[model samples]
Structure formats: structure tokens, C-alpha cells
Target: MNESRVVGQVRIVGAGLLGASIGLRLRAAGVDVIVDDSSPSNLNLAIDYGAGRAARDTDDPALIVVAVPPDVTAAVVATELTAYPDALVTDVASVKVAPLAELRAAGADTLRYIGSHPLAGRERGGAISARADLFIGRPWVVTPHDDIPTAQISIIEDLVLDLGAVPVIMSAEQHDSSVALVSHVPQVVSTLLAKQLLRSTEAAISLAGQGLRDTTRIASSDPELWVQILGANSADVVPILRDFRDDLDGLLTALAAPAVPGARRAVAEVLADGNAGVARIPGKHGQDRRFSQIVVMVDDRAGELARLLTEIGGIGVNMEDLRLEHSPGAQVGLAEISVLPEVEDRLIADLEAGGWKIAGAWR
Candidate 1:
């Protein structure tokens, strides 16, 4: 079936971030959306935000998207599949294997159900934080079982494309393992690092900088939700965590005996491995392109940053990324602008000619 025909009427079972985001995007595209949530307040908030209308008995949904929490995903998917027998059902829950297993155990129609996860979300939850562009340019994994018809998989892929997300096909087990490493493990690490701050002195926090903030930012995520996610994927996550713990132990041993033979080399090897791992990540738009960064020192006063950006724009070089850093009590801010390697020389030369001080450039 075609995209529009496949997704004529979408019923979203949860009205949280993923649910509301899906509703918003579908509604914006002029598709009919019906939203329902266990929480009446959340349902109302999603409706108020123009995500979708309340469900009615007469409405026969062509598609059902389960956006509920991980703990309730299987139950909700089963319910939705039973309620809308003709509709193609899918889910946005982060974990896949457990929910699919639960559905199978519940005797739900697995043939019509496709498991999917849009690898897009904010640290914050709820409809109030929903955005239409959340899934743009992100990987949306679709896990289809052996018994599922190819046509059913196509419908789900069409829906993913409708949200401007790229679809990656994987089995349930593959999806679970991939997210365990990329998403679940990072969240656990971030939370553990943030927990250390709770016991730290105010004087230590006063000296905190961007590195600390970046590492611990996701620690602000809802703990209860994470508990459910981690529990659901614990089988896949635990082994990775054990290996990570071994690495940490090695690092601690190195730190404890910095002057011991081979200890310093071990520490250096660990750091070098991190650099290699980071470099392996895909760059802008999932391409392998790496950009050169030029750091410009700007006055802390207002309008200075805007002036710098405007000057760079006038130089006819498109900046791929920008990061701003300011030291506490300092009168200057550092703006690191990333651009194509070929444009680095011209950009730096133009910026200097336009009376902007350049700190350095790195590839």
C-alpha cells in the first residue's frame, strides 16, 4: 500500500514525548491522528498541543503507534492490536526484545505488529516538550519478524520517512543489542557520573566547567523512566557494564601507581582508544566528512557574538558546527566554529581581515 493509504488514520496509544511528537508531525502533514494516554492530563495536554483528537468508537484507525513507557509497552501494544484488528501496529519503546516476547506470550497477532524505535528524544519528557523535528535525520530502527508480510514492513517504513527519519532494518535481538551499547550504557554512565556531584563540595562545583556539564547533562532525565528502560534491557546492558567496570578498574590501578612500570602506558592506551572510538562516529548528515575548527575569541559584551557570526556569514563560508565556552569571571568568550577543511584557510584569512582575532585552527 502507498504511504497515505497506509497511514490514513493513526491512533497513538501514549501521549508522551514520542507519541505527541508523532502526532504533531502527522497532523502537520494533514494526516488524521487519534491520541490516547493512561494519564488524562497528558492526553488533554497532547490534544491541546494539536497533536491529535480524542478517540471515538466510530473511528477505525488504519495504524496504531504505541508510545507508552517501556514497562507498559507490551500490554498497550497487545491491547491496541486487539482493539484495532485491521490496523498495522508499531511501537516507539526503546527496548524491543522484551516487549515482543511479552506480546507473543500474550498471544497477540505478531504478524501485524512491527517493532520500531525512533532514536530521537529530549532529556525531558511529556507533550509540552514535544517537537515536530525530533526525528529529522535520525536513525529509526524497524524490527520485523520472519512472519510479518513485506507489505506491512513497507507501510511502517513509509510512516518513518513521513517523519523525515531514515529507517534501518534489524531483527529484534540486533535492535536490542545496538541500543544497549549506544543509548542505555551512556545513560547509566551519565547518571553515575552525576551522582558523584551530589557528594561533592560547593567549592568544587563552583569550579565546574563545560566538560562536567556536558557529561552529566542527561542525568537530569527522569529516573523512574530510566529504571524501567534499564530493567527491560538489563540482559543486554549488564555484560557491557561489566566490561566497562573492568576498564574502570584498570584505570584506577594505573592512577594508584602512576610511577609503576607500564602503568602510564596503560593509561595512555585507554585515552588513545577513546579518541579512536570517538573518531569512528559518523559526522554531519551521517557522512564521513570531518571539518576543521577555528576558534575565535569574542568580547563577553552583548552583540559581540552576533557580530562575529554575521562577519563569518559575510565571508561566504558555511559553519558546520559551533561551540561557545566562557570561563567564570572572564571577560572573553571562545567561539569554536567548524567548517569544511578546504574553507579553513579562506575563513581564517577573511576573519582576520575583518578585524576578528583568531585563537587557533584544528582538524
Candidate 2:
């Protein structure tokens, strides 16, 4: 948290993952955070965890954050605006366009409200999985509304910065469209792909590895929550999904005729296009750069991976990414650590010298 942007008080509605995480971070930064929830047990749990104390009628929050589900986001924001007349209200909902539209239709105090969506989360939910640093280095979108002044949005921007997130200003429409492609559609794709595994045999599923895990990990997310998100943004999400269906049809046709003329070329073109798409995605620190991976073999026991990481830290090499893979019947696991290309050879040299077995290294 930054001292200059130190807020006197923040009242967060909905003690779920986002709200509790915000409270945890703000409370740790010496800010007065009041966390409230419809479920008293959930509220008390967050309070007991020191995310924030129970709300008091005398509390005058400088800012209010509504972290409820997407379906009720607009209603909650409207209620917050009416209750906290002097406070600015923002939300952590996934969809922006519908909520803002609903607020306008209801004739709420629009000038004091802004819509926010932080592009960060895990497959899990609830306050138990919340962490103070969850939003660190993540993008938090602030939607532009006609009622709010350009200067008034700065308060929300400061709140984002104080949470260690990068503030990305976008219009409500742009935010909805962008997230449809990047987040909502991906959830649908992952869930549908994971559904295919339900019919697999034990032996077939035993052969699954990192690739399948990577592609379908988000399938574990709460379906109840995702239904609301996807439905709210379906206007933007459906068209992209239709495009994907067309591409898949072409791919399936090519795979069905691998020996036919031009079929192999069609398949190769699809794969090459996929490679290009991946290369366009930003890497570490949200920059377009390459990373080199160094896989180290570790005994599947306590402290082995810890020792490996401690030694990497001791060498002052920043790990851009990491992935762990362990087979059920194997005694050793592969720790794939990604670092800058420039440090690849030096890292392998240092690790091998330190008695660490190198499984592989590549860019």
C-alpha cells in the first residue's frame, strides 16, 4: 500500500473472495476496513481472520466496494450509493456493461458509482481462499461513465494502485468485450473440454499430464457463479464461441482425412496459427518477451523443491513462471522453472554444480 493514497476507511459489501481479499490487504496496510456480508457466519469468519472488523453504524466509509455476484451487482451498487451518500462506490463484478445499464435504468446516483473488474482469481472461491496479494501485478479495469467526472475516477484508480494492481482505464463496453474474449469464453471452453473426461476409463485418465491439466484447470471453478457471468456477457461471448465452433469443424475435418490432399496442410496451418496466437500473448510483467524453461528433477519428498527454490533465490535468478508435475507411481517430480533466456545456461550451470539433476532446458 502507498502512504499518499492511504484511505481513512473502506466498507466492503459481500465477504466473499474479492471482498475478503481486499479487506485483508487494506487492513494489513493500516486502513480502516469494515467488511459486511449477508451471511453472518461468513462475515464473522472474515472478521476472525483479521480481514476487517464488523461494521458499525457510526462508521463513515470513504469508499465502498461491492464484491457480490454479477446478477445482483447493480442492485447492490444502487443500495450502497443510497446508504453511503458521501462515499464513492465501486464493484469487483466480472461484467460491467449490464450492471452500469441497470443502474442507469433504476436512476441511482450514478455520479458516485464506478464499475471495476480485476482480472485475477483462482479456480477456488470464498474467504478461506482469499489472500492479501491476490491482486498484485494484476490488471484492474475502471469503466468510464458519463455521470462521473474524469477527476472523480482518480479516487478509484488510487484504490487500485494501493492494492498493488495496475489500473487499466477502459469504457464499460470495451471492458465487457475484452473480457468476453479473454475470460468468459475461456471458461466455457475449459469447462466443455473437462466434461469430455467424464467418460474416460481409469487407465485412460491415468495417462493425463500437464497439457490436459493446463487446458482444463479452470473447469474446477464454481459453475453457479460462472452461469451468471457467462449469461451476462453472452452478447459478446456467443459470437466468439461461434467462430471457435467454425474453426473446430475445419480442424475435425482435416484430422478425419489426414491422407487426403491438402488435409495435412490444413492441419498444419491450424497449428501454426495457434503458435502465432500464443506468441502474441504477453509474458512476465505483461510484456512481449520470451522465457526459457529449466526442468529440474526433484525427489518427491518434503524440502526437496524448497531447497531447489532457495538455491535459485540464492543465485539471484528471477523465476518468471513455474510448473510442477508428479506421476502417481513415480518417486521423483519435474519442477519446470521458467526464467529469462539470457540466464538459461548460467542457471543450469549453477544448479548442476549444486548437485541438482537437470531434466531438460529450452526456450
Candidate 2 residue 326 Cα shift, in angstroms, is 1.0
> Model 1 compared with the native: what TM-score?
0.94
**What's the true lDDT of residue 243 in model 1?**
97
Runs of candidate 2 with Cα error greater than 4 angstroms are: 1-4
lDDT of 1 by residue, 162-237 (tens): 8988899999999999999999999999999999998999999988877887898888999999999999999999
How many residue pairs clash in all the candidates, one count each?
0, 0
lDDT tens digits, residue span 1-363, model 2: 556375679999999888999988888788999999999999998898888999888999989999999999999999989988999999999999999999999999898988999999988888998999999989999997896887779989988988888999999999999999999999999999999999889899999988899999999999999999999999999999999999999999999989999999999999999999998888865878979989999998899999999999999999999999988889999999999999899999999999999999888
Q: Which residue pairs in model 1 clash with each other?
A: none
